[model samples]
Target: MNKTKNIAVLGGDARYLEMVKNMSKSDDIHIELVGFDQLNQGFTGAKQIDLDDLELSKLDAVILPIPGTDGLGYIETVFSDKNLQVTKEWFKKLSKHCLVFSGIANDYLINSVNEAGLSLIPLMERNDVAIYNSIPTVEGTIMIAIQNTDFTIHSSNVIVLGLGRVGMSVASKFAGLGADVHVGSRSKEDIARATEMGVTAFHMNELSAYTSQCNILINTVPALVVTNDVIKTMQSNALIIDLASKPGGTDFDYAEKRGIKALHSLGLPGIVAPKTAGEILGTVVEQIMYEQDLGEE
Candidate 1:
C-alpha cells in the first residue's frame, strides 16, 4: 500500500484557508494546519495542531505563506495570537527529502533552508505563477485607482514604472480603460514591448520629465526608483500606487509631505481575490509535487 504524504501548512492569511481546502482534496495527501486556531472553518481531512506538536521528522512537505518570514524569523499569521518562528533549528528536523514552498523568500528563510540542506521553492519566482498572480493584482490596482482618483481613468495620464509581469498587465489594463498609459523601464526590450502594446514607452532615466503630467503613477519596481526628485515633479493631486513588495519603490514620506497621495499596496491577490489566488497556488504546488514524484508508492 502507498503511504500518504504528510504536508504541513504554516501561518498565512485567508488565501491559505482555500489552499488548505484545495490540498485536502487529494486522499494521498495528509495536511497539518498550524497557527490557524482562530479560524472557524474546518478542513475535512486536515488536522489543526500547534507547531510544537508537529512531528517535523515526518513532514514530506512544508508550505509557508507569501512574504515567507520576517528578518527576525517570525512567520505572518493573521489568525494566530502567538508568534510562529521557523528557525534554522526547526528546519533541521524536516525529512531530508522534504520540500519547502513559499510565495517569496527572505534572507533569513534562505539561510535557514540552506543550513538544513533542504530544497526551497519560491512560487512567486515561477513565471507561470507570476503571470497568473498579475490578474488579481491588476484588478486590485484598478479598484484602488478608481477609488482614490477624482477623475476617470479614461483620458487620465497614467505612468507605470517597470515592465515586469505585473507592470505589463497594469499598463495594458489602464490602456484598455482608455487612459493615456506611459510605461517607464530600464530594459530596451521591455520598452519595445510597451510600444507594441500601444502605450507610450520611455527610459526610466527620463522619469522626471513625465511625472509632471502624470495623473496616476504606478510603480512595480522594487527599488527606490520613485525617489523624492520624481515625486517632487509630479502634480500635487497625482496618485501614486506602489505595487511592489513591502517598503515599496516610492518615497512615501516625501509624497505625504508634498501632499501627494501615495499608497503601498501589497498582497493584492490575497486581499482582492483570495479564492482565485489560493487556487493558483494550489495548482502550482500540486504540479511541483507531481514533478518531484512525491506521494507515490
Candidate 2:
C-alpha cells in the first residue's frame, strides 16, 4: 500500500531547486515543478507550469518557501516568470485535503489554510527538522558574530536570549570558543539545562540586570523580548543580532537612534550557507514524504 506522492513545488529559490533534485532522486516522489521557467536556467527535467493558472485541486501536496507568508497570505516565488501571489481565496480552494508544508508558516497563513480547511505544517516547527536545522542556524550565528565584530569570540561576554535550539547552540558554540556565554530563558528546566552546560543562565526575570555588560547580544526569542528600556543598559557599540521571525526582539528604531548596531538577521540558511542549508531542508522534506506515504495506508 505504498502510495506515490506528487509534489507541486511553487516559487522557491535554490533551496527549492535542491529539494526538487533530492525529491526526483528519491524513488517515493513524483514532483510536478510549477514555475521553473522563471528560475535561473539550471534545474534539469523539471516541467514548468504557469503558477498563476495553477489548479489547487490537482496536487497531493504543496510545498512553499520558508517564512511561508508574511502574515498576508502572499507567497514569494523566486521560480516564477511573474510575481506569484497566493491569496486567501486560493487557500480556500486548496482546503480540499491537501497537506501544505513550508519551513516557517505564520498566523495569517495558518488562518487562511484553516479557513480553507486545508492542513498546513511548518517545517521549522517540526521537532526533528527544526533541531537538526538549528545546527546551520547556530553556525550562521557564530559566523556573523565573527564577521561583524572586531573582537574575538574567546573571552567576549555573549548574551543569548531564549534557550531554544538556536539559542542553546549559539551559547554552546560561543562557550566552546572560550567566550563567557549567558542564556536568557523562561523555564526552570531550560535554565537548569543551560547551567548544566557550564554557562551562566537566567530566567527572563533576571535578563535586565545582567544583559548590559555583554559584548555580543544574540536574541532568539520570537517576540519583542528586547525593548528600549533594556537597550539603555547595553553599551553603545554592542552588536545586537535578532534572529526572530518578524518585528524581532530588538527595538531597531531605538537602537539606531541610540547609535547601537542592531540587526534583524533572517534567511541565514540561504544567505550565509545555501548548500548546507539546502541539504538540511532536503532531509526534512524526505521525512515528511516518508511519513506521508505511511499515512496513505
lDDT of 1 by residue, 82-147 (tens): 889998999999988889999899899999999999999999899999999999999999999999
| lDDT, residue 104, model 2 | 76
Backbone clashes in model 1, listed as residue pairs: none
Stretches of model 1 off by over 4 angstroms after superposition = 1-3, 294-297
lDDT of 2 by residue, 57-163 (tens): 76668888876867666667665646566788877776375788887777788888888888887877877776776777788888888888899989999999988
Please give the TM-score that candidate 2 achieves against the real structure.
0.88
Model 1, residue 102: displacement in angstroms? 1.9
What TM-scores do the predictions have?
0.93, 0.88
